[model samples]
Target: NAGVTQTPKFRILKIGQSMTLQCTQDMNHNYMYWYRQDPGMGLKLIYYSVGAGITDKGEVPNGYNVSRSTTEDFPLRLELAAPSQTSVYFCASRPRDNEQFFGPGTRLTVL
Candidate 1:
C-alpha cells in the first residue's frame, strides 16, 4: 500500500493567490500532520489531526488551514499566499506507535 502521497509536487504562485496541497495515505493511520521547511530551517509543524473530524493548529498556522475528514486524507489550504509561505510542505501520518511516515513533499514558491 502507498504509505503517503502528495499532489502538485511543485507550484509557483503570485503573492495573494491561494492553493491547496493534497495528501493521502493508504495506511489507515490515526494521526496526520502538515509541516513546512524553509531554505535554512528544519521542518516545522503547521497542523495536525488526531482522527477524522478533529484538527488543530501546530507551530505555524497563520497562512494555512487543514481538515481531516477521513483517516486517509489530510489537505492543507493556503489562503492568500505570501512570500513567507514559500517553502517545501510535507505531510505525514502515523499510528499509535509514534513513527511518522512522510510524503515526498510539495515545493511552493510565492513571488
Candidate 2:
C-alpha cells in the first residue's frame, strides 16, 4: 500500500512517549528492513528502504515513520507510542545478492 492512517490519527501519549528506533548497518548495503516481534510471535515488517532517500511501508507501518537519509542509518520514529506498539524491534540489512544481517533488536515498551 502507499500509506496508512489510523482512525484516530493523533493522540497525546499519557505515560509512554515517542521514540526514534535506531537501526545501523554497513554503508555498502542497499536494502534495509524493520520488524517488530511480540511475545511468542514472529517478526512483523514495519518499514523498509531500497536505498538512501527511498522508503516504503511494510505490513505493520502504523504508528511508525521511517527515513533513509544515509546508507549507514535508517531510523524508525515511533509516534504516540501505544501499549500495542511495545515489542522488540529488529533491523536487518542486505546487499543485492546476500542474505540479510539483523541486529539484536531494540526493546520498546509503550506503557
Candidate 3:
C-alpha cells in the first residue's frame, strides 16, 4: 500500500490472551506510532519509533510491546491482553514535519 495499512480489522480475545496487530506503510516515513482508542475516549499512544532499530514508550505502553525492524513495518504486540486493553488500535506514520497517515483501525474485544 501507499499508506499505513493494518491487518485483522476485528478480533475477539479472552482474558490473558495475546496477539499482534500488524501495520505496514510504503511512504518511507521515518516516524511510526501505535495508539488505542476506547469508546468515548481519545486516542492514547502506546509506542513509537523514529526509525528502524529505535523505539520508545508513549503515553500508554503498559502491557504492550512494539518493534520496528524496518522502515515500513511497525507491529504492536499485546503479550497478555486484558479487558481494559479492549479498544480500537490505530497505526500511524509521518515524515519529518509532515502530517500523520493513519490506518483504518483494528477493533479488539476482550472478554
| Better candidate by TM-score, 1 or 3 | 1
Residue 18 deviation, candidate 1, in Å?
A: 0.7
TM-score per candidate, chains pooled: 0.98, 0.83, 0.96
lDDT per residue, candidate 3, 13-56, as tens digits?
99999999999999999999999998788999999999999999
Computed on alpha carbons, the lDDT of every model, listed in order, comes to 0.95, 0.77, 0.94
Instruction: Tell me how candidate 3 scores on lDDT.
Output: 0.94
At residue 100, give the lDDT of candidate 1: 98
Name model 3 segments beyond 4 Å from true. Answer: none
2 against 3, candidate with superior TM-score: 3
lDDT (10s digit) by residue, model 2, range 6-95: 112223344458767776675478899988889888989999999999999999998899999998788888767788887778888888
Residue-wise C-alpha lDDT for candidate 1, range 2-65, written one tens digit per residue: 7899999999999999999999999999999999999789999999999999999999989898
Error of model 1, residue 69, in angstroms: 1.0
Off by over 4 Å in 1: none
lDDT of 2 at 33: 90
Question: How many backbone collisions does model 1 have?
Answer: 0
At residue 102, candidate 2 shows an lDDT of: 80
